[model samples]
Target: MPPPFPSRAEIEADQLEQLRALVTELFPANAFYTRKLEDCGVTFDVASLADFSRRFPFTTKAELVADQAAHPPFGSNLTYPLAAYTRFHQTSGTTGAPLRWLDTPESWAWLRELWTRVFTAAGVTAADRVCFAFSFGPFLGFWMAFESAQQLGCLCLPTGGMSSAARLRLLLDNGVTTLCCTPTYALRLGEVAREEGLDLGRSRVRRILVAGEPGGSLPAVRARIESLWPDARVRDHHGMTEVGPVTYECPAQPGVLHVMESGHYAEVIAPATGQPVSPGETGELVLTPLGRVASPVLRYRTGDLVRPAAVRAACVCGTHELALAGGILGRTDDMVIVRGVNVHPAAVEEILRAAGGVAEYQVTVTTRGPLAELALAIEPAADAGDATALARKIGGALETALGLRIPVHTVAAGSLPRFELKARRWHRAGK
Candidate 1:
């Protein structure tokens, strides 16, 4: 059985203990954290979470980037010596330069254990044939997931580098009962299955586990994926390379997700001020992955927008771990102010997804003029005709929903590039 989440009181005590231990373990050998903590007048005698938050400075991507640049290859975030480390992984470099992260044998094992719990939360077992449908690379996306699924005693199939059709064939031929991929790739596979005349709805696959994007949490997008595979359920997994698996969509609550409070500490703070938001109010997600001495992120700012879950709400999972209202609303950095009207691409995506005729769409922000402008390009579904009319309708609908006039263009069928990994949905000028 999976490790049950501890209660709030247990989490508070455990987190403080872990925080103290982390400080002791890292401050000795890790120059990066030692300087960071000491500069802020922080010490081992930190009393509460509030004290920890106030005394310790928040870790940002810019600092990590600068640190790595100063120290080539891997940064000096390691508590243990290089000889003590065994694992190597890196970030996707989505925002800027790719951050090269190293882990000690202990920390590597930490990640493996965390992933096992993640898989178990998704209800995977040895009997399930898990097919990894991700494009494997240096990216840490499903690399750990593949390893952890194997740990679950399941038949782990690595379909990396294989074509969509080939992957579909592997899933069907091998009796793959569960799939692990990004939400975009899952939908791409559905499109391929339709094109290849393969009925995915009748396949043996029963669960679709998705990560690396907000699509899984979107009811409209989740519904579309679920519709493609009739009996299959879509589970959303949220985490980052810096932070180990932090949260997973629970089977007990269905759409509601619980954070891995036992493994990591979480806080919801105002994106600009770093102050804790009011209960149930939206804020940026600040994470602290405990026990990762080799590459520990102390009160790291994740830039992910989220809301704190209420206490004693809905069906309790027997473990009263902190729950998230809607998993990852959007990224604080990704939110754009379009002509005085603030907009998140995800908000637009939600509207487009609900509109129903879009097969695939991309949002482009043009900074060519004094005022920032937004445009939408979409490929209409096969059955949907009158592309011009559809685009016009979508444009009008976006105007109504966003309270701003935005231009919408129709792209020819199969013109828009499809993504196998994280979808690059935004195209900006003068970056």
Candidate 2:
């Protein structure tokens, strides 16, 4: 049987012990960590969280990438021999070159446990049928999610190698009660449902757990998906190939995601200063994997920007930790400045979804002279008015939401690309 999910306090205490043990185990064996820990005068036996925090230096993707390049295949971060690892996976390469990640059997089980929390939080039960809408690949798309369903005793339905229409058929035919996919793909599936004239709202699915993008928490995006699947509830989750599923949405709180600090240590720091920021302040998310021993990361900076809030009010779900206010507002890298105003693609997506005339949209940033401009190409609804009228509505909505004027251009339906994975909605011309 799987271990019962521990409370935040319990997880923290357990992690503290694990941290000390891992430090000792890796210190002499792994040169990368040995140098990192030794430089900070941190020994393997830390007695408190504060002591551990002070001992470990911040880990960055750039450093990991550099190490991988220096030592091909697996980086020098490995504490044990390469033969000890039983599983291999890689990053999505959405940000850069995919960094290969390996895990021992024990660590792989921990990954499943993290995902099990995801399923449980989304109200997944043994009686339910869970369908994964992912192309089985090295990117860790839904491989763990599939394994998690089995761990939870749920019937797993693999949608790999099937078309959207076929997946829809399987979903309806199998009475699937839950779905796991990227937020982009959920919307894409909705689009496919409309094309096939299938009433998705009436489908048997009761819940959807989405990750890989901020669309799950965007009001308009969430609203649109809920509108299409009336009986289904949409929940957001956050994870990375290097870090397992470390945060998930609680049904009690609609849009907020609770970070599982028991199995991980999470911190929000000013992106520029690298200093800890107060609660409710937007900052870069830095994570430490407390349970993933095979390739544990300490203070790894995740480019995701989030505002963390202290858990004061008791939640309906019981487990307590920090919660992200709006579930990954946007990535620090994805933020753009247009006409002296900051814009996140999610902000634009929220406005477009609320306006209701857009079928699809793309935001492009280009430099003309010394000024940066924001231009949008949108596919208007079938019954919507002319392109100019739709454009005006979009511009007004954006202005109201962002306090900035943006140009919206109506484009032919299907002109802009649709995404099944991460949606590259915003393009920055010339790097």
Clashing pairs counted in every model: 0, 0
Superposition TM-score, candidate 2 onto the true structure:
0.94
Please provide, for model 1 over 90-175, each residue's C-alpha lDDT reduced to its tens digit, 9 standing for 90 to 100. Answer: 88888999998887778877888888887898889999899998777877657789888887899999987899999999898888
TM-scores for every predicted model:
0.95, 0.94
Native-to-model Cα distance after best TM-score fit, residue 256 in candidate 1, in Å: 2.4
Best by lDDT: 1
lDDT of 2 by residue, 133-159 (tens): 998888674788899899889999998
Best TM-score among the predictions, by candidate number: 1
Q: Which ranges of candidate 1 are over 4 A from the true structure?
A: 1-5, 312-315, 368-370
Report lDDT (CA) for all predictions.
Answer: 0.83, 0.83
